[model samples]
Target: MKTTTTMLGLLLGLSAPALAQGLETYAEFPKDTPPGNIAIAPDGRMFMSVHEFYGHALRIVEVKPDGSTTPYPTDAWAHAPQEDGDGLNGVLGLQVDREGILWMLDGQGENQTGRIVGWDTNTETLHAIHYIGQPAARPTSFLNDLAVDREHGAIYISDTGDGANSAIIVVDLDTGRARRVLEGSQFTVPEDTPMIIDGREVKLGGNPAKIGINPITVDPTNTWVYFAPMTANSMYRVRTTDLLDTDLSDADLANRVERYGDKVTSDGSTVDTAGNVYITAMTDNAIGVTKADGTYEVLYQSDEDLPWPDGFAMGVDGFVYATINELHRSPVLNGGEDASLGTYRIVRFPALSATVSGR
Candidate 1:
């Protein structure tokens, strides 16, 4: 890992003035394709999933320091299947664990089933593949984001299932068993609030985007998993121990959920060692923090509308990197017209406290 001062100066070209201002542009991308989730490896390598909504040909890419991208792992794995063998299918949530294993959430697997792909960056080999289908996943299940709890040998996923049947799917890495918990519970369901951006209601398919349980993350110690619906005002959390317990019934697990703090409509989140939850406050065009005390504060606001601060990744360099893709302006949400300005960005700023690379 590079020192923070050297990284800010050499890699990002961030001046002292810019550092004080917050949210410096670290990288940029074209509007035709948008990045969904971001994951930074301990070695300072960055990876991102092409936002599934855009239907880009590339599912995942390794972003270089020069702002160029290459099909990650291999060209064959980054694109749709041509002949045979495995490839990433609609990957949204991805994180590089402490062991250098990149876990990708393939929400749209073959036949629209869901799966988790773990690739060991250290050995350059496939680590494991766990299929999350049937009773563990619903017909409308959109397995959006995931949190890798290395401490508990489990993976927690947020299945935003058509808003009505949203739930959390826990995958035991040791056994490759996935169990759906808290289905349709208040903790997983979205509130009635409408997502308003730029003073206009953001809608999808001519209806308010009532997305449920979008951003999911684990703390530095991997003790608690914090999450919230994309349209909700409050963030919720649960102990990893309870989530990994196979004996806990749906009702019993629901009782363990606790409201962590108040948050604005957000897309992604990551926690630090100090317990501050960094949120992509999309509605506010800023990055906000929910302190350990359960109080919220805006940490960095963009000069212009920041569009949608889609995902977050704490780099080894001590800065939190985020993707700024204008998702609300996409044709899917803009009534069949592309309203984007044709430029997207990845920005970074110093974290409030020391943090891990991937959350």
Candidate 2:
């Protein structure tokens, strides 16, 4: 299989090497449809967010073990209007909790306010829904990723603020109240650092997109929330307690932020039961894992074959699954021409040596 990928790359003029030993292609999307985000349910089932970014209709569907997909919840949730209770504008970051619940953050492509929807995967029933509109978000905000604290009954979201301001929005699950916090911290701002792929800086129309805090995850212990900006070389974390407290002054909460460690240009991340953090090394075209002691290693790497690795989710069956598509090679970034030469793929490898749980 590795040889096949390498051969394909060569034929396309890409100098990609063979995939690392254990990496395997789990599924592939047709050339017309590109993947957006992936999440794993507690029952070992996989779900993918299908959106209009790649010319596909908006929907969230389940990817079965044998490579079949069925619309999750229902087609109604996917195509519902913006004003309806169960309407879904679009889904970006998807997460499944330990209790078999599916959570989705819908950005709706900046035309409307974003909302978060939670559903019981087992029952296929709506559990909770909250709108992050006017008071909690600005029109320029891009609610990129999220970390759910089940025990604390809260959800922490990262606002990328593509053309506006950046901040962390903390939502109280019980009351559906969300407040923006830690606005304008260096941790949430785009650094001067540039993201490179295949030894060349990734640019959109000759200029790199200034992405802010995007990837976020909660440690197994639920004590800390870890996050990083797409343009940064370092990771930052803060106590969950401080983030949940609205009484803390912005300066005081900012003081609580602690630098986790240096990291590469990363997109998505999750921690294993052993407290090891696995991140998508977007620039290196691989998965990078950091130990509890702060050591980093390239867990899996492929040449140009993998493209820009994005979302990650650890399944109950003991493998971490990731969505890989040529995001940097898309027309929006690639001088008005589609550079994503082939099919988008989802790949997974054996999970870490132990169990991983967020609760």
Candidate 3:
């Protein structure tokens, strides 16, 4: 059987002497199991959503360090309940705020974008993206990833749309005013196009299959921006001062973006306190890590056995967390059912311990 280990070794990314990287897989699921996004709490708990995206089950599960998992309270918090289909209103994006609040991106699968939700890490208190930027166009344009600059009292969101590719939507976390910035910079799209995944190319519904910079991670010091098109293999960055200025014209901001070293064709990425980037790669099927020197390393190559690694996060004790969504062969990306989809996985590894949290 072709496993993550063999495939990774076949790709020539594995290090010699068996990588010392200590990664342990704590959980697995059966067919139709899809893990949306992952976030880590200071309390050492790992939180993630389930079900195929677009039509979320609105279910969030918390995984213990020892591999046990429990359901988070979605029934008590979801204000917009879903019916008709077995949908929990897909929970696509998740992040932990500076204050330890868990913010979730609820993307309704009815061809409509959904809401941003917040759960108090300490008290389990729930809050939506209220008083901040709401969806620009609901039920269609959905919320994606989130970057909270609590230092500045602002939250930045990515709006992935159907007709419109995407836009950077900012919310005044305190006042609730939402503003759209950088609308048309090789980023947003007006029509749905075809995208290629694995060895097959498929169109996501009618949505464009091209890359439009979906995943974003801020620099530890909040001085720079790192992002990539979920479909592309390279990563890019720009000074955070440029994007946050709000006064800079879209052209000016676009010009400020600096192309960082091409790490790998990555999907989701996160940095530790030490400025090391843990990026997921479909082609590599391993976490392509980039250090401060611009050199890179593949920390663990499928030792825990993953499929289409996607999300990255650093939890308590500076451990790395990742989700294997098996997106590479899905109908949304590939053209049909892929063996990769039958089971879902979450893998963890102890990354370099540094205090870098991208804002």
Candidate 4:
């Protein structure tokens, strides 16, 4: 437990909380983000997904440590352009493997297809090693967020179908095998409403197209899979043993579930090596964490342009990084035809109990 005590003098408010930098804004993309999700690569690179409608080509950008960035450009491996129209729409999720490679949830999208792309850090080359949106079993389900378990070479994604429903899609990176698990659970709906922080109601996204289980995360050891519906207040978790085995159907896996407990209204989630689950409380303007014991706490809050803090991932320096997609702050979310997107801020907070550099 490191305690970083940055002077309240560095930021606004003489009475601001005594801690390390609350939120440090990074990048703010000019595009809209329907539901934002972020991930940190093993090498410290950052990946993000923004705006379901126009989130194709430029949606996912890789940020370097020095702040310079280069787009992971490719029609199939990268985000598809908005002009491609519905048939080729691509909004994605990302994960980094143990070998320092990045894997993408290439939501082949409206075409009812998706692909998992692998990018080699050493070569800066993109490889389409896994493809899911095939004709045999095209569900056209919402392929939202992604989490990878390096131990078993598996990746889990949230289907989040258009019928306002949810399901977990598992990809065996080793075998290129994919399947759905843990279906039909209460936590999969958009109105599960168990999220309670300081007794304040966590407001789920009220957007017309919004529905359940938007953000998904995994425990440190990959034992528990945690997820929440974008508009739902409550949160829940189920064991991975049930999700990984093909013999057990989603209905059967759903039966072995457990409630991780409620959270404030949230948009995205991530976990660290310590078994702590971090959630982006869109309504709280703060990041929340669920400890190993099932109790939760507000880890930090943003004071700057950090209006809507979204997806989160821990960086190499023990800093928790997040995409402050500022969805609510976007014009479309605000009900305007040409809504300006919020700053795609990538802020960092010190690890638990970590104090300011000088403190």
Candidate 5:
């Protein structure tokens, strides 16, 4: 609800159609830190991960209505020692379920283990902790994003592995067991594509970044899980039933995968009840959608290059909120020198139809 005078001035300058489409700045961060992913509670509370790529101190914070941020849950939990088994290691994905549980995905860096922590917001207590280690999470695994399937009692994670060994990790919430699937498969691996941003190729460690299987989301019905590689041109999906079927062979599971639609190089995505997948089209500096008919369209294109739209969260207010962190300019992606301009943003627009909050 806090709209700065500068943002209001920018809004006044937008074209009529852009305003009519409902795209507008929601909040802005004037600091050097960058936010990675966002999760909205049914009561309108906003939480975001301070991107690990930037090596910031705070891991996650709750963005207040006045555009200020405070350490989420508690300062102790946010800054707890990872080795002490009481804090978040590296979190980039989180969501709130129908029961008011905020599930956070912690990809333990260096340790190479991953775990999902569920916090009960309604009671302000710890709900559950499910560790994903060993064969389920490879040494090179970079657990990026996740989709919660409440109907199936599971959580699906995209392991953007060392590019070549990328896979989808399915975790059984009931038993805390995990299985890595689709390793080295075309659907999970990135294509030989270069991410061209601002007329230059984005690179990491002096090489073109080939990130794989970054965006993952489940439909409103929780029937299908849609995901795609960060550098791929197409989206792919599989039924939640098939993903939870442990009896199915790898080949059978691979055969079950289907091409969803065409998507530009993107980061975060969310689905509406009408079966539309809203994408953060980072390559185009725009927000687009893959409709029910499998056709894609640009819904909102910002006049100023949207730094890097990173994550999506469907709010109870009927708007789809996203974080714009300018990640491509991070020191890790750039040549060890941060090129990001301050005043990062969290933007929102009206959803095409009803969407599930905390998605």
Candidate 6:
């Protein structure tokens, strides 16, 4: 296994070790057990979701500083329930909000309905469960990512449909009402571009598969929601006020969508306090940051164990944590059996200058 250990240089006024100048493997998962995303609370407790593709049987778990893992809230929630209207079926996107609450976005799965659950970190109890039911959620809807707009009692989610029905779902925390917007619009659907990883095309069943509207982020001011397709290079944003207004017609909402900037092939995303958006650049095996002025720069690139930096969480401790899970190397995408070696990793670097807003 190749590991690059060096203190990282400080960027954006944040100090990092030289060995870990850009990427640091903070923790490692057992071989074949890839993590989905990482969420760090205000108290520095780190939690991660297990990717269903790896068959971990657990939805989410907490990572101790010593690297031991334990299920969060309870063991039962980690092993999610299968009923349609109850419990989490799949957990992909997770965020720790300003109020010390952990928000979980459960995507559509077998016998599982799309839902968002909020857990109060202090109480260690389920605070709220908002299910996206009926016309807003279809069987094809793959709720891939989320951004919370706590002040407006709303949560924005990206429904990365099965290549044909991509859209954005906005949930009202107050009423548990979820609305699907921009369904099948050019802004939401994936382009016909092939996904490349490790200089090779990522294929499923001998055909290249593309992910649509897979990355979403809420700016620190809670004013805009930025998103993009995992297989595309363009990034776009829409005002939070516009997203929450039910009166706006689909045409009106689509018109409000603003092309923020161009990004590398990205998976998960998070916004820092200064309005800079950091994206997990999977193809480049690094993290990329987009400034408020719509300019982007490769903040950190690595060629070591960080083969694919998939998901991200801008931590309260001024470190941005990511799940270095190489999805392209999974057996399901690799003609039945994975021949890859090395452990799945969780890496972090000094990141956001402040806590993420909108719990």
The digit string of per-residue lDDT tens for model 4 on 95-124 reads 666576776676754444576667776577
User: In model 1, which range of ten residues has the least summed lDDT?
Assistant: 1-10
C-alpha lDDT of candidate 2 relative to the true structure: 0.77
Which residue pairs clash within candidate 5?
A: none
TM-score of each: 0.91, 0.89, 0.79, 0.77, 0.92, 0.89
- Candidate 2 regions with alpha-carbon error over 4 angstroms: 1-19, 80-86, 108-111, 204-206
Cα displacement (Å) at residue 201, model 2? 3.7
Which lDDT value does model 6 have at 88? Answer: 60
Mark the 10 consecutive residues where model 2 has the least summed lDDT.
Answer: 1-10
Best by TM-score: 5
lDDT agreement of model 3 with the native: 0.61
Predicted candidate 2 versus true structure: per-residue lDDT over 40-152, tens digit per residue: 87678788887444545656878877776777778778654656465677777888888888889988464677889998988879988788986688767888888888989
- For all candidates, what are the clash counts? 0, 0, 21, 26, 0, 11
Query: How should the candidates be ordered by TM-score, best one leading?
Result: 5, 1, 6, 2, 3, 4
Give a tens-digit lDDT track for model 5, residues 170-209: 9998989899999989999999989988777999778898
The per-residue C-alpha lDDT of model 1 at residue 110 equals 50
Candidate 1 lDDT over residue span 137-159, tens digit each: 98888899999988888999999
- Winner of 4 and 6 under lDDT: 6
Q: lDDT of each model, Cα atoms only?
A: 0.83, 0.77, 0.61, 0.61, 0.83, 0.79
